[model samples]
Target: MATAPTPVRHRPTITRTAGDVGAVYQFACPCGATGEEQAARRMALVDLNEHVLSLPKVPAAQQCRTPRTHGNQLWEPCGLCADQTSLFDLEVS
Candidate 1:
């Protein structure tokens, strides 16, 4: 008998939180991953982007395609959905 493969969790979104004046900035992912505190906002953003890029890529076909709403308007083909499609296409070609 073969063991079943573990289900892959959707990539956790990472966000950067602003710190008090003179305090260092920090970035954290919902998956419990975190970055070292940095004195610059740019550094914090870089850390967050790096974490997102490091996660395993989900196939475009398997990614969520749900419509997203911004303000009062509904965005057909969510930005994330578009990005995943483009990214996957790049990897395949």
Candidate 2:
């Protein structure tokens, strides 16, 4: 008997780019879904967070809370706070 091949999974990547006024962020999923523009750096991260969080396929644990862009480097979770808390902390400020 032959087995079926597993499907490929692609996560969205949020990239920060400099804008005419200020820093801007654009997130694009492998499926071609794009995120909104945010003036504030943190706000941009929040937009990316919300996009991924809304997806039914992504689990709570797998969702990154404190995502940071390291000076044109890698984008990953900072592991400082939980997904829920991090969102609140960033928004409340």
Candidate 3:
């Protein structure tokens, strides 16, 4: 008797939004600083102008909430967000 082949499952893809890309910034420690200093020395993941320019074309997978604030704009809180409040039990002003 011949057995039927199983079907493959497809995963849904996430879409990135302009707000998501601008939410948080990433940084690298040059002096290998730890603790509070590390956070202070963090750099922007993407340039201000560049980030704004690419916002419209961002991918879905890269979309998410961030603590970064631009002018009067506000973003949702998430683990990766720059805002301390969004970072688990960390407090924010």
List RMSD in Å for every model shown.
Answer: 9.8, 13.8, 20.3
TM-score of each: 0.50, 0.45, 0.15
Top-scoring candidate (TM-score): 1
Candidate 1: tens digits of C-alpha lDDT, residues 5-91:
453332333344556657677777656777878887778778877876776554444445664332111212234555566685655
Give the poorly placed runs of model 3, Cα more than 4 Å off.
1-51, 54-56, 69-93
Q: Candidate 2: misplaced stretches above 4 Å?
A: 1-8, 57-93
Better of 1 and 3 by lDDT: 1
Model 3 C-alpha lDDT per residue in residues 30-57, reported as the tens digit of each score: 2231121111112332333233343243
Clashes of each: 0, 0, 4
Whole-model lDDT, model 1 = 0.55
| Sliding window of 10 residues with minimal summed lDDT for model 2 | 69-78
